[model samples]
Target chain A: MAKKRGRADIRERFGFAVKARREELGLTQEDLAAAARIHRTYLSDVERGTRNLSLVNVERLAAALDLSLAALFGRVDAGADGA
Target chain B: MAKKRGRADIRERFGFAVKARREELGLTQEDLAAAARIHRTYLSDVERGTRNLSLVNVERLAAALDLSLAALFGRVDAGADGA
Candidate 1:
C-alpha cells in the first residue's frame, strides 16, 4: 500500500527540485530571485519548503529556470518515492 | 523564436488538463469539487482559468483525480505546443 503524502512532503520535494536546478544552473539565490522577480528571502523560504506557492509563482520560477512546468514537476516526482 | 507564454496561458492550460481529466472520469463539476474539498464555484473558476491556484489545492485536485502530480503536469505539457 502506498502511503499518503502530505502537503509538507510536496512542498519539500518542490523545494529540493528548485534548489537543485538553481545549483545546476550556477545561479545564486539572489540571481534566481531577481530573475523570478521574487525577494531573496522569499526564495529562501521557498527553498526551505515553508512557502505554499501558487501557480503564478511556480510559473515565474519555471520561466526563470528555463524549464517547462512539466519538467519542474518531473523533478518533484522523481524524488517522490525515495527522497 | 518561442513566443513567451503568459501566466494566463499557463492557468488556462492547467485548467484544460483538469477539465479533461475530470470528464474522463465521468465526474461532474460538483463531484470533483466535493472530492477536492473546494466549492463548486471555485472549481468553476479553476475550470475557467480564472483562479491562480496554490500548490495545496492543485495537490488536492490531483489526489481527487487519482493522478500523480507529475502525471497531471504531463497533461498540461502535452497540450502545451498544440493546444
Candidate 2:
C-alpha cells in the first residue's frame, strides 16, 4: 500500500513555520498580513493551519517576515540546535 | 472580500516545475520515482496537479532530480529567455 500525504499535513507544517517566524519577528498575524499585502483573516487561517497559501503569497509572506524563500521552506531538524 | 488560493494552484505549479526538471534530465516519471524512492503513482499525482508533497519528500525529489531545493521551488517568470 502507498503512503498517503494530505493537504492538512502541508498546511500544518507551513503554519508552524509561519508562526515560528512571526513570533521571532515579534509580529502578529495582522502585522504580517499587512506587510505582505494580504488579508488578516487569511493570514489567521494560514497560521491556524486551515489554509494552503500559494507560492506567490508564500513569497510575499517570506518578504514580510524578512526571510529568504529557501529558509522559509527549510524544515527544522531534530538536532535541537538553533542555526 | 478576499482572494481565494487553493491547493490545486500550488500542486499545479509544483507539477510544472517537476515536469520541466524531469524532461530537462530526460527521465521518465517511473525513472524519477525510482530515483527518488517514491511510488510511481504518487509521483504521477504530484506531477499531475493532485498532490502536495511534504518538505522532506520534496527535498528527496529535488536531490533525485539533481536540483537544489531552492531551484526546485523558484518560480519561472514571464520573462522567459531561459535561465
Candidate 3:
C-alpha cells in the first residue's frame, strides 16, 4: 500500500474514499449515482479515479454519502497514511 | 457571519478559506498563484467563489498554501459553521 500510495493521485485517493463509503452503506454505483444526481457513468468514472470532477460534484457525492466534505477528505488523508 | 453562510455557496466558502489562508501567510494573490502555477485571474476567480475548479487545481492551491487536502476542506467545513 505504501508503494502504491506514491502512484495514486488525489483523484484516486478521493475515489477510493467514495467507493469505500458507498460500499459501507451497501450502495451500488447506480444507487449512489441516483442519490448524488449524477450520471451513473460519471460516477463510475469518479470511482475509477479517471474524473477530475469539480467541487460541485464532489459536494453532491459527499451529501449522498452522508459525509461532510471534511469527513470525506479525512478518509482521503487516512488512506494516504495507509490506514 | 451566520447570515452570510446561508447565501454562501460551497465555492464561496472555499474561496474564503483560500483568502484567509493566503492572508495568514501574508501572500498576495500573485504570490499564491505563482506558487500554485495557476493564472492570477483564475486564482482571483477562485478567491471570489466563482470558479468551480477541479480536484487537480484544488490540490495545487492546497500545496501552495502548505496544507493537505483534508486540512483545506476542514477550513471549508469550519466556515460552514460560521467560524
Q: Point to the candidate with the largest TM-score.
A: 3
- Write down the DockQ of candidate 2: 0.15
The residue ranges of model 1 lying beyond 4 angstroms of the native Cα positions read A1-8, B1-8, B81-83
For candidate 3, give the docking quality class from DockQ.
medium
Q: lDDT for every model? A: 0.86, 0.68, 0.87
lDDT of 1 by residue, A1-83 (tens): 14364423777788989999999999999999999999999999999988889988998898899987889998887877756
Runs in model 3 deviating more than 4 A are: A1-7, A81-83, B1-7, B81-83
> What pairs collide in candidate 2?
none
Residue B8 lDDT (model 3): 63
Best by DockQ: 1
Give the per-residue lDDT of model 1 (tens digit) for B1-83.
14355323768888999999999999999999999999999999998988889888998899899988889988987877656
Each model's DockQ score? 0.62, 0.15, 0.55
TM-score of 1: 0.88
Chain A (candidate 3) TM-score to true chain A? 0.88
- Which one wins by DockQ: 1 or 3? 1
Candidate 3 is scored at a TM of: 0.89
RMSD of 3: 3.8
* All candidates: TM-score: 0.88, 0.54, 0.89
Best by lDDT: 3
RMSD of each: 2.4, 7.4, 3.8
